[model samples]
Target: MSNLVTMTIASEAFLLLSFIIIILSTKNPKRNVLWVILFIIGAAPHLYLAIDHVTNDYMDANIGLGLAFMFTWVYSVAAFIIAIILLVKKKRDNNISQEQ
Candidate 1:
């Protein structure tokens, strides 16, 4: 209906897609890094916005939340958590594989 709505939907879609890629890539050690990269891609925007929001001060900030901004933060945090989990799992899997 509007540009903001479209962007919000796209951001959510990215989060979902990256999450699935990360989960599937976990089984392939070589692809695990790709998955983490996708995860960072997903997190980058929100993290950028969140950091900007803080650094610029919410009042002077150019990006207008208007509303629905909370979801961006939520998505960013979720992406970050997923990335950390994937990294830890990858490392653990590497250790186990090496022992054999």
Candidate 2:
């Protein structure tokens, strides 16, 4: 009912959809599952904040929230870096296999 609830649901749904897409599109489903898990862990704080907002209807600009946001940002950056590494490794492996 609240905007926070709606946003949280939408974010979680989007993450689920992303996980599905990663699993379907990748040759390595197991590895993608790990990625999804990492993403879920990274998003846990945001999820908690959303639930807090819904139940308490109180949004506090506190240090904990700031830390959570920072952690989320760090996770996002880490994910992006890891993705790039994986892509490069995959491409190199493909090239090597092709040459052989």
Candidate 3:
């Protein structure tokens, strides 16, 4: 198996694990942010490898790896957007509830 494949698997696993952690968390803003940060960190290694491999075309790689890297980046961005939306919604809900 190629290193790219390994990195892709690891990246996906970490992303999934992060989602699970976020879902299981008890709706704490601080904790949720921490988890998202950790998830991003976990994803960094894969993203780096993907970029390096794609940019340099190193290690006799093919275009498939490039596609995977692009997909991973897209997923990361989507995850961030979703997290932010959720956090904002939670804050708004909290504020409304408190005022009432």
TM-scores of the models, in the given order? 0.39, 0.62, 0.48
Report the Cα lDDT for candidate 1: 0.62
The total number of steric clashes, by the backbone 3 Å criterion, in model 3 comes to 0
- RMSD, one per candidate, in order: 10.5, 4.1, 8.6
Best to worst by lDDT, what's the order? Answer: 3, 2, 1
Task: Write down the lDDT that model 3 would get.
Answer: 0.64
Residue 65 error, candidate 1, Å: 8.3
lDDT of 2: 0.63
Tens-digit lDDT track for model 1 on 1-100?
A: 2564566566666676657746663666777677667656655665465445445644453544433356555765676577668868888989999999
- Deviation from native of the Cα of residue 71 in model 2, angstroms: 0.5
lDDT of each: 0.62, 0.63, 0.64
Candidate 1: count the clashes. 0
The digit string of per-residue lDDT tens for model 3 on 1-100 reads: 4875676776687466546645553376668677667666656756676666656745664665566566666676666566567767777988999999
What TM-score does prediction 2 earn?
Answer: 0.62
lDDT of 2 by residue, 1-100 (tens): 4654665566555555544544544577668768677777978987786566556644545456456656665655655555556667777888999999
Supply every candidate's count of residue pairs whose N, Cα or C atoms clash at under 3 angstroms: 0, 0, 0
| C-alpha lDDT (0 to 100) for residue 33 of candidate 1 | 72
